[model samples]
Target: MRKLPNLFKFDEISDGDNDFKQVMVSILKKEFPIEKQSFFDAFESEKYKECAEVVHKLKHKIHLLGLEEGYILSANFENQLVNNSFELYEDFVIILETIENFLKNI
Candidate 1:
């Protein structure tokens, strides 16, 4: 099961009803696989622009989901990739799959 506070700080950030968090989690669960496939396909095609764009958006949701370490790591990697660091692609593969699983469980 997904951890409460760790999955999100909704207890403190929301009105005890998890309005925002619930919406985010629902969207994430629904889009996880599509997003995962998109990332992998982009990476395989070396389409850094598309991959970075998608990952940048994913980072925002991840930050709000309370996966701060992952949010930071992914955002940084995406930024680097967009700026010109193709070397980060391999590392991104590992983190992307991890994040995909993390969100899927929600």
Candidate 2:
């Protein structure tokens, strides 16, 4: 079986010259939360309006960043939330955590 590589390996969120980790760090610094905690906390409330908005903005940026996988994952999250599908909360949380962890490195 062929294993797929992590799709967030490269992007244009920051200067193209910078590598993956650097670009992620740059994005985080520019964004509200440079770490995972704030990112998670944004979705930890009933007023998930901000979360949805961020997802939308990030979804657009992800394409420019060339991170279709993350964009797709985030879109699913937004979709489920918008449609009141919280049954997969735990599973989504795992995916979100994985995204945050991946951002911690390249």
Best model number under lDDT? 1
lDDT value, residue 44 of candidate 1 = 79
Q: Tell me the TM-score of each prediction against the true structure.
A: 0.70, 0.52
- Can you give the lDDT of residue 14 in candidate 1? 55
Q: Where does the lowest 10-residue lDDT sum fall in candidate 2?
A: 1-10
- Candidate 1 vs. true structure, TM-score: 0.70
Please provide, for model 1 over 42-99, each residue's C-alpha lDDT reduced to its tens digit, 9 standing for 90 to 100. 8779888998888887677567667667677787888887876866666556665666
lDDT of 2 by residue, 1-106 (tens): 3122253544333336567656565665466233234445667765466666665665554444445565676688777767656554565455545555554564
Q: Evaluate model 1: give its lDDT.
A: 0.69
CA shift at 33, candidate 1, in angstroms?
2.2
Q: How many residue pairs clash in each candidate?
A: 0, 0
